[model samples]
Target chain A: MKQLKTRTEQILATMPILAWVAFAAYVIETGAVLYSYTISFVDPEAAKDVYRGLNLYRLSKINFWYYTQAISLIAGLAVSKAVVAWLVIRALTKFRLENPFTMDMVVRLEKISYAAFGTWVLAMVSNGHLAWMMKETGELQGNWISGEFIFIIALVYVMSQIFRRGVEIQTEHELTV
Target chain B: MPITVNLDVMMAKRKMSLSELSEKVDLTLANLSILKTGKAKAIRFSTLEAICRVLECQPGDLLEYDDGNKK
Candidate 1:
């Protein structure tokens, strides 16, 4: 429908900054947690003891801290992707570029496409790494593979197509309209 | 052949000024001028419909083929 008025566009333009702020807050929170409670600040041995105590269920628990770090990394990356997308859309509107097919849109979409592909690759490889860690603790027998991983792979394919189609639409719109 | 605008005829029949037509159609006068002078590369069907409704005319009344003006 794209009946965006001036006021709406202004608000939409601010959304990416808001997302960045929120993502930064999570990063800061994680940093704060690492600094305050874990005696790992002054004594590596003490930190190891604390982690070992919590990871007492290392045999039963899933790949512990590695999983948490991976999730946070993926989340931060998702936020960055959103920020980039919002910026490109805002810049296109601001410059009054013809459509998505111009050099500008191509570059923007390319960045998104590459990011999506790279993230999928990272996730897949990290899943392998996680599988290895899980095997060390023998947690791979029951839930070695997450169905969500398959979903993520599928999402990568779908999004790549979507990004490609958006480019095509922009190109056609520019040429014909 | 090129499309020719019949803005003068519509304006005369309605006794409407460009400003009046702009207000009636809720479009900027500059945009209306662009359409009137055939300077615009494209026009939305909605805009054409609005113009037809406000002027009580058909698309043929506002636009015509001018093959003789091919220069």
Candidate 2:
């Protein structure tokens, strides 16, 4: 018998495209961070107005070790976040609403949780560096503070646990006679 | 996992094929195969009743508790 999909599954079907869009945004963000870092060194004159008039190029020169370390941490966090976004896309691609609970989906969810955890760690490190820089350099942390990654990690970890149980239940149900 | 299925023995005694039993019980052949191979995690009472009715056997005849079956 064919079952009509609920509104949630219908939305789930559309979520993959949204996930891809998010992935693209993350890629763009990583590229922007790397570009800003490289431009600060390659063209000191141009770096003054790159980040919406932040003048991070001149900021780096104020104290090279502190500013550069904070910048590197920011870049690392961006790259790790992009990796997490890519993992989310992969998990969404493997998910099927018709058969939502499968070993493959469970494995993918676990992988996403792991990646998210790694990203969260990187976020914590970046946040610490940025916080210290804010104190010394008096520069605002702005959006560079990534404390939000902890929430993302918790969400994905809970989802993976639920999916693991779902896989077990589905297996038991299929084997029932 | 120690609960063992004796469906094959019961079917042989009743001179019934897996397909015949599946048809009489209105269950899919794959489901019947799963039960016969002892891979089934559970059996519904209605399903056991239907299978017993088709094979002319008791639930005890179709299933057995085996101590040696650790898995």
Q: Using DockQ as the measure, which candidate wins? A: 2
lDDT tens digits, residue span A46-163, model 1: 3332221332233323444653453344444444445445544544454332233345544555555565455556556656765775666554221123436556545645654675
Deviating ranges (above 4 Å) for candidate 2: A1-6, A50-53, A145-149, B69-71
lDDT of 1 at A113: 52
Model 1 pairs in collision = none
lDDT of 2 by residue, A41-150 (tens): 77666546544554565467777676567566656766777777788778877777778888888788888888878877777777776777777778744465356657
Q: Model 1, residue A15: what's the lDDT?
A: 62
DockQ of 2: 0.82
State, as a TM-score between 0 and 1, how close model 1 is to the true structure.
0.37
Per-residue lDDT over B1-71 for candidate 1, one digit per residue giving the tens place of the 0 to 100 score: 18888887899999999999999988888788877777666667888888899999998998888878569
Q: Any idea how many clashes model 1 has?
A: 0
Candidate 1, residue A164: the lDDT equals 67
Best by lDDT: 2
